[model samples]
Target chain A: MAEAVDVAGLVDRARDGEPRAVARLISLVERGSTALPEVAAALAPHTGNALVVGITGAPGVGKSTSTNALVRAYRAEGKRVAVIAVDPSSPFSGGALLGDRVRMGDHATDPGVFIRSMATRGHLGGLSWATPQALRVLDAVGFDVVLVETVGVGQSEVEVVALADTTLVLLAPGMGDGIQAAKAGILEIADVFVVNKADRDGADQTARDLKYMISLGRRDRSGPSWRAPVVKTVAARAEGLDRVVAAIDEHRAWMTEHGELAGRRLRRAAAEIEAIAVERVRTRFPAADELAARVVEGELDPFTAAEKLISGSLGE
Target chain B: MAEAVDVAGLVDRARDGEPRAVARLISLVERGSTALPEVAAALAPHTGNALVVGITGAPGVGKSTSTNALVRAYRAEGKRVAVIAVDPSSPFSGGALLGDRVRMGDHATDPGVFIRSMATRGHLGGLSWATPQALRVLDAVGFDVVLVETVGVGQSEVEVVALADTTLVLLAPGMGDGIQAAKAGILEIADVFVVNKADRDGADQTARDLKYMISLGRRDRSGPSWRAPVVKTVAARAEGLDRVVAAIDEHRAWMTEHGELAGRRLRRAAAEIEAIAVERVRTRFPAADELAARVVEGELDPFTAAEKLISGSLGE
Candidate 1:
């Protein structure tokens, strides 16, 4: 097993600008195995540098097209970009079609642009259990900007994107489900909105409706300091992408200036760490399976089970 | 405090056809409190009798309208029905709008009809945590049929609907996001498909496309036995609702003949018990919090933590 992987050495190689090492590290994290702890420990010191952006919307809203456009815009500014595409599993085959990679074909040969597609694999969220680790690997590998594109507007997608530094919600004109999106959890998490295919007839109306829906939730006092902007875009043609990039930059700057960026990152990091800890306890303890069986059999309650499990683990 | 709610007594009263007791019992189950073990045990023997039909689609696909039509149809057949309309939490206030109840106003006073509106309440699935409990309560309370209508097409919603004995996916004409729905995990779990708003243009094409997609997934050499019928309805006018109900009845008959109905009900009961068990652990266990804190501190890993927690509980 290669002596359980030299996590520290791999991290060092990745930090030294070795692309293969970086890729390998990400693969390890994505596997989310027992060795993940060592890899995460090694990569932890190098993270907290990349600006993570989340792009999401209903499918066929041209999310990939918009992502490609945004990547091009960032590349034009001489910035290194990493794109993570979360793909859905094939219901028939239970494997990913890898359609997301094909959608972003233009970046296939671009060295400055790195693309990876992930599958949910039965994770409750539209992300893999190892997504956070993969992100850390990407960060340690020195990507200045990271873009996470969720496959669709499911609740898990929204929750996953909420962990990003800036979340951009993409919508197509004439979806007529704008209010539905707002009603669902997507509207609350977006820091910026893009009405892709703005050339369509109802684009203006959709924008107006979205703005109105947003204003309903704007308390004007206790929420975030900035208001989410609705940007119009023709992503395929790359029109209005500069404005999108500019909006993202402005949001980043505002977050940084207002201290919200660091605060949010801290919270996200805390959540990440907490999730990791719970996962570890579950993996290391043999009694966890028995407890689950008891709960399943209705012989023991879940809450009491949880308490006993934790107490035992802490040697109480 | 009211003697801490005599869970067994409440379950008995609900089973004896007391509406107030049924409602209160469902509330307890929905809350997923530490005391749920007692409540679940009391109700376990009384459940596994009702037909659970889950209806889901994007908002404005007329899911509510279709539900109303179905309710009217089933009621006309002298079948006692329970409708559980699961709505999303309001983006502005983090509260449920209860819009589904308003849309279902006609059944407000019908003695044979039970209408309940549930909020997503931060649950990832579109269905509320209390849904299974509510369904069980209804089943035990003597309702022969239960219908669950989810507000949107989310993975959670799909998962919730998948728990139902029959799942009907409502699609509206001219939505233009059918492929997107397919990608978002809607196409796989559908037991029956309804192309609502058949009066609208392009209904035929949409139906054709949906049929083709269904055909793509049918791999069973015995041919799935039950062909998912594509019923076209204009629910606003109560058009073709009879056909929808007929389709549901046909599915029920097929399941009964194949012994699938009993098996499905057994599975649903098991699932309900499993959910209740997990909820109990979550409620009684403080370890989740501790593990979460460790994850935040980067001192542990998530997967391992989850496994450890589960195993520890098993030992209890």
Candidate 2:
């Protein structure tokens, strides 16, 4: 058995801006450690204070560069910033990527900034189970802003939206046009769109295409809904980043005014709670292997096996 | 109330190779219909006959062309083939991709060939829950071969691997080298490797790089293990596809000899049963919304709320 963790002590240190303490807390979340309940109980009251921003886009869309730029922007405004860079494709997890840190430059030494990369390899429920817990950790640890950066592929984009109060979808010219973005379903979840690499040749056409698509999609909405604004940025050179920041701020303000922020948070909390509850139930069913063997031998169908397992475990 | 489905009649027609019956059964699986338990019970005994080959590759890697070529190759052997082309990116779902049909012209009219495109948008557990069930339906419908094709990204690739008897990972010359493939964790699950678009420049270099990486990775394995063979193919032109077919056959034979085939199927069945059980538990916990509201309001932490929910719902 693992030794008991001093959850309250860790939370206190984390709140005092001790980076290692914050890192340890997040590590517990990532591992889905047994002490998580104690940790959650200790950290709960301090959370709900930080602004959670989700940044996502396909690979080569300048997500990390834009995240670095935004971290600098947030830091300049005298706010402590934490970045949770989630690489669903990565199998290894440690601190932030060295390559990304090199691009991020001076922020490495700044005490006000913390960066961590999370890998979802071999984890059940993947990001949906771990990410929100990590966010709660950072939120409780006194970060004024937390940026969740994830690859925009498969279900990760949707999962990120479920965890964030505001989501930014990034695109680059020549990578794909507006229709392709819509096909990927990014248009549905984006609170703000960032057309990164604005210096590229087709930047204006991409932005125009996005605006047209946005207008086409908005035709059916009856009430007041936030129209996602498109902002262009050459993030590598740190050009046009101010507008991206402004758009994000505007989105936050709009959500706050319309009570959408509270609604999103409640949904996120519900999702987190449900994910945890399902996982707890999963652990109680140890007969899954035997049931599966029977299924392989053609003695039972999968659905019936599932029903039997549920009743056997839950005593229903 | 929805009318009860005549699942037994549908299964009988599906077993008789009736295309409409097969399609309807698969549709039920894709939709996660209320009739799923009845469908599973009927289909269970007839499954375990088809050879499931999972084809996955990053976008721009000629996955569709390769799948089309392989379908034709299997057809030439008088094998009835069913293709489940899963597009996680596409929100629209119906039959096959029309563009793919243009390339696979003759097969569109072939009575032995069946193709369907499934979209994972808004589905819980995404492909993991649905794809295996669809595979089961195809298996039960008397297809000699089932080719499951999906984009290689994030967790979908891993999920596909779990559902396939043999998984073929495709790569192109220009789309990152062997190191990049390894970083994506594809190297671990691939039973065979196909270097599609081999007519392009640098194909030989890409093949060599993959071989070197494979050799490096194999050094740690102690006993006899399947060394994934790298096959080259210009799939669009149907060049060098015979070797790809041979490689898949060889992998299947090797697995059967080593008893790994039964092992893999058992694991897949276990996963399916567990996912269903979790979903069942999730439905029983109607208190999740109220619990989530409390978490959002800081009246309860998520882990504690989850604990309360499990106990309340399961009477634990």
Candidate 3:
């Protein structure tokens, strides 16, 4: 595959503000090919400089719209922004539809904002296997703010977003089952919550319910201390965009004050490393087709078969 | 923690139909501790015998009621049934609410029926990492049929159900987002479809919509053509369960006739082993807390740190 893009060269070009090199680096990461190790090493020194924000919620909650608004608000302040919209990969198609761009049409022509759609690509985790590598490339390209918008809600998405410096969970009014939103477990991870479509009748009620739910947090100190601030927004109308941006900024400032920003970044790094290790084992094992065939033939017990494959490669 | 139960002893007892051993084995699987390797090995040969039926739907769609009715229907036919209800691990408590049991009260006194609830327990995939192992235990205990009930609709749950021999995607009438369900990509995986609460208004429209969707599939010329049967069920009234069971049986007959059973089982086994390999790597990696601290200190970049960890333990 053209010897996979030269890692050092790509990193150098990305650091010199070449968007093409940044795109190439992300492509290598997304593939999870052999060039990943080299690419990762090349971009190692340039990362840890960008402020990463994670946006997640249930499907059809208007997260893409809220993300687009957030991006525009940041760009309005003259800051370069990078948006990574993570789309779920279709197993049958082996590709993501990536309809997120349809919602962020305004940012497409803005030179200061870079938007890329990433597919999970059969990765178990909600984020793509190459996400960390891609983030490094974006960081190297000097994006002051990097926002990761996850495609769906699940434990994997939660874990991926936990890597972000600030995580915002978007919930829409009149979803009918407000409890369903809570059941998605997004409430626990959100540093800031937004009730989009605030013009709806139940917008205030949803905010109240979310606040009540947040007050039920049992782990840390209670009341408003561990509560996520609920912001009301009409993303389509761009109303309350300033308040949403201010809340984000306030959360960032709080993290910095509490020294949680550095801690969160560190955890994110550790999680990235752990994910990479797991990915290595997955690649070294026999292909799924081969293993399936063996299991079907009764030639190997799945447990023993898996053990042999894993231990033979990585050792228990 | 307590010398992790002797795998050989547990396997022997489970094979002899000891209830305690079966329960213990399932607990081991649910915890997904280091003891999993031994447990998986001991139970490996016992699997590939039970027919796995996976049931999934949106929450409050009466999935639990339908599952209960199915169990009752199967038991009435003199078939021994085992149900494994998968739920989200409570992030706040780490304990599963195990609400499925409350809906399955009728089976409480049935000696031939065994029901267990499994929490996702942070497994990257929607399934409990120990799912295959639990199934093996149930199979060894001589359950004629095993039913896997997934918690709510999402990618992970849908995927876990896809691993089953026959996947039944449940739906309710008046589901405001019937179209959203279609877009969620659930339609493609279902082998048998059930529209629960069929007495409700708009039920026919939902059924018609689903039938039209299924009709879009290309016809197969080889073997018995499998069409996803749409069954209407009012589970509270114990209505239409027979048709659902018949559809499952028909699917099984078709699978047996076409020699697809062995292939499907093999695929499931292969996936189980692949998951094990990935889990092993996760366990062997450094603790997340320590790595996170290093990243926070800026002593190492996430990429370089991850590369070092993976290369050191998992690479040649």
lDDT of candidate 1 at residue A304, scale 0 to 100 = 49
What is candidate 1's DockQ? 0.09
Clashes of each: 47, 0, 0
lDDT of 2 by residue, B43-146 (tens): 88888999999999899999988999998898889999998888776556533456456645768678799888777665756787788899999898899999
Clashing pairs in 2: none
Worst 10 residues of 2 chain A by lDDT: A90-99
Off by over 4 Å in 2: A1-35, A38-255, A308-316, B1-3, B57-78, B87-113, B122-125, B151-158, B169-189, B194-213, B230-244, B277-287, B308-316
**Cα lDDT of model 1 by residue, A1-316, tens digit:** 3338878788888887676787787676666545776776666556678889988888799988888899999999998888877766632453343564475478766777777777766442325356777787888678899998888667557556657999998888877555876777667888898999999999999999888888886866695568889999999899999999989999999998998887676666545644554444444456666655554444544444555555554232
Model 2 interface Cα RMSD in Å? 2.8
Model 3: pairs clashing at backbone N, Cα or C within 3 Å: none
- CA lDDT for candidate 3: 0.74
Q: Tens digits of per-residue lDDT for model 1 on B1-316? A: 2238788777777667666786787667665554655665565455556788999887788987888889899999899888877766642453343563575479867777877777766442225356765676687677888998887666557557646889998888887445755786677777788999999889998898888777766665474567788899999999999988888889889988888776665555444434433443444445666655454454544444454555454221
Candidate 2: C-alpha RMSD to true structure equals 7.5
Best by DockQ: 2
Alpha-carbon RMSD, each predicted model: 8.5, 7.5, 6.8
Rank the models by TM-score, top first: 3, 2, 1
Distance from true location, Cα of B301 in model 3, Å: 5.4
- The TM-score each candidate achieves on chain A is 0.87, 0.89, 0.82
What would the TM-scores of all predictions be? 0.61, 0.66, 0.70
Clashes of 1: 47
lDDT of 2: 0.86
Candidates ranked by DockQ = 2, 3, 1
